[model samples]
Target: MTSETTRKKTTEKIVVVGINHAGTSAIRTLLAQDPELEINAYDRNSNISFLGCGIALAVGGTVKNPEDLFYCDQVQLDALGAKVFMEHDVLAIDTQKKTIRVRDLKTGREFQDSYDKLVYAAGSWPLDIPGVPPEKARLKNIMLCKLYQHAQELIKKADEPEISSVAVIGAGYIGIELAEAYRQKGKNVTLIDYETRVIPRYFDTEFTRLLEDDMRRAGITLALGEKVIDFAPSPQKPDHVGQVITDKGHYPADLVITAVGFRPNTDLLSEAEKTGNGALIVDGAMKTSIPDVWAVGDSVAMYHAALDRHQQVALATNAVKSGIAAASSINGIPGVTVESMAGTNAICVFENNLASTGLSEAAARELGLPVASSYIEDADRPEFMNDYGITRIKLVYHEKTFRLLGAQIGSHGEINHTEVIYFLALAIQKKMALPEIAFTDVYFLPHFNKPFNFILTAILKAIGLDYEAAAGKSLERRPSLEGK
Candidate 1:
């Protein structure tokens, strides 16, 4: 028999908990590459590989079929030689013994299974206030925006004729996206945030100000710098949430969505080494504190490229990348390592597309770094081009070293507008200095770009370097124009 066939005959059982983005990616990678491994994946939820990120698009009617959100199912996993337990909930893990206690949600049967290896990819859950009692907080019209079911429920509630005013708590990505979604549905949308601005964590005040203007123009109300106290029942509809009570004031609402944020789902491994936020601490190889056990996805803290430390970043992109890393490490794959992430992200607000990589000016200041920032406004293409649009870029770097710390880009729906931010993410990871990008060579086409690339212009401006003078010097040194 071949080595592969022989290895498959003496299979090693690998058990994976939670089949979300991370778990699914891990299992698929392991099965596809390592035929010697027998994989069993468990999840309490019936669905597998549901794209929770797409929920906003669905609510906005950008996604036509809700079913398309799920990319994989139990049957598909079974076809790939994985034992899929769709409604199986893992209760506790015995790391020393390499055993897990699981409960079948459908039959209420509980059992223990042993594994040669265990991977934790439980993901995250929406955070609820502690002091507020569940009865007062959990109103019929109040919803969350984390899961596929939550999206369906929100869409159903929005379709109701009685539900007119919608209050979205937290000005993070999901909150802002759902607010716009409700506004597009012709509902009166009011976004409430404890912070002073929208997406305060990822965006600086300047970028947020421009976005806030767009929000106001779109008729979406912003109730910033207010803490949500509780959700109270409406006097008219006692069963539904009628009012959103905040520390500053109260607002009338037929429906409320709490997109405050999420916490890592790492309760099962409470004894494991974790960050303050309860995210398990894993290394570049995706190995957890416990031996023969690994963790990936939102449940674990990932190395932040810019910060040079481990931080919890709960994005699907991180999940998938770390998941594959975990599998490869377990299989003894050579030359595979998970790189530190820069927390690169992008979003579209109304007609504006905003993208960011690494730390923002606000984030750098909060970290107490001596930073310098530059903002530049220029057209995406030549001014004479009919399809030209305005593009604004913000670059942040260290004052002393001029090392790029972060970058943000905003454009008026220009094609491939996020490319500059994507490039900056890599540059920050490489520890590139400002001078490297200030005079970087970039191809130019009048139809798609200006003579001087916007990224180059922004970098030059960041260091007070004159782009015109630098271009003139390059022309003067050209061999063909030496005598002219």
Candidate 2:
């Protein structure tokens, strides 16, 4: 251990660079466990813990109170014996000297501070289109749906009568959700993406095809397999972006939202080892390449159990885990490891209840790994039960080793078998193979599941077994959507 780790101090002053989900989790954990520890946090935004996950719900009116998105604030952090400075931008980090430069956004003030420990949770920023015109910047209608302010603006634009058409670029989770949200508001919505399939990082063609069909049937233009070139300003309203230019066609849109993705805001750590995407590469203990400094939230590229490598999986759950892990490590708390994170996520959009964990079959194959998948479609409960609904579940595994790698489950009905993904995610973490999962004990209830459930039957089908004596698969059809 380094001298810094073993050294005792009356109060270790911790300077956290961000106050979002990851940063909030870390500060709360550290000060909560040891109140004497000094915690000072800085956030460029006016608020913290704005759940980007619920932005779509808020936009679609599912979440009535837009303010409900924020779970933590400056007042809460202050009450926890931590001083949080809102709208304070971190200018630079001098890792060797263990100091940082900061600027008060509200004033023209610049200052330097030293800390015994640093938590680099600067989080991430939404990706913008490259090489756009000045109009793209000045245009107020063009949106990026990743922030609380962005959500409020989206809600406002959706209510504007002039905003009749919506074009969402980058049909990933954020883009898809915003598209659905605008569509729910009775706008002409078009979801555009460079990829041929939506959410390809999670599900395979069978699932995406279903999702695409559902979106199309719901009057959402699926401009897939097309590259978005730029946003073209409206001739009538020169101050607003009115169209999206793709290589294939020019889409008319009164409002344009880009949800391409995000990049970790970890540029201040000049000497820290980072991924190809600039996410800090941290170990199991959440310690970065630099000593006495750790990274959490989207800035940390965590070890993925299924991929068996360090990857930038920037989900809120992973952020919270890494934050707690870093805090635990700093507090001398052992046996706290976030090494088994599987990138487990679920989404319910349009009519599909979908969930996925670990690597998809396509991703496994793209990596040139020997991949196999078992797919099954059946009722959630016994056929005799009048309330049963059809659910589709697929298991992806190593072809020869049979080690569980990933799983995807979806259904059109109200039945949410997504919880099954938790077990599969754990299996992936434990390196459990098909045989181990196949014979695992599971409940059988008429209302919940059959004697041999979808989870059990999926493994059985993979091993060339027929859980159904003579009956074929049965399920009711449903529309598809949701992600990240």
Candidate whose lDDT is highest: 2
Q: Model 2 reaches what TM-score against the true structure?
A: 0.94
Give the TM-scores of the predictions, in the order they appear: 0.93, 0.94
lDDT of 2 by residue, 341-433 (tens): 899998888788899999899989999989999887777788777767778888999988889999999987466779889989999999899
lDDT of 2: 0.87
Model 1: colliding residue pairs:
none
lDDT of 1 by residue, 253-272 (tens): 99898888899999999789
Strongest candidate by TM-score: 2
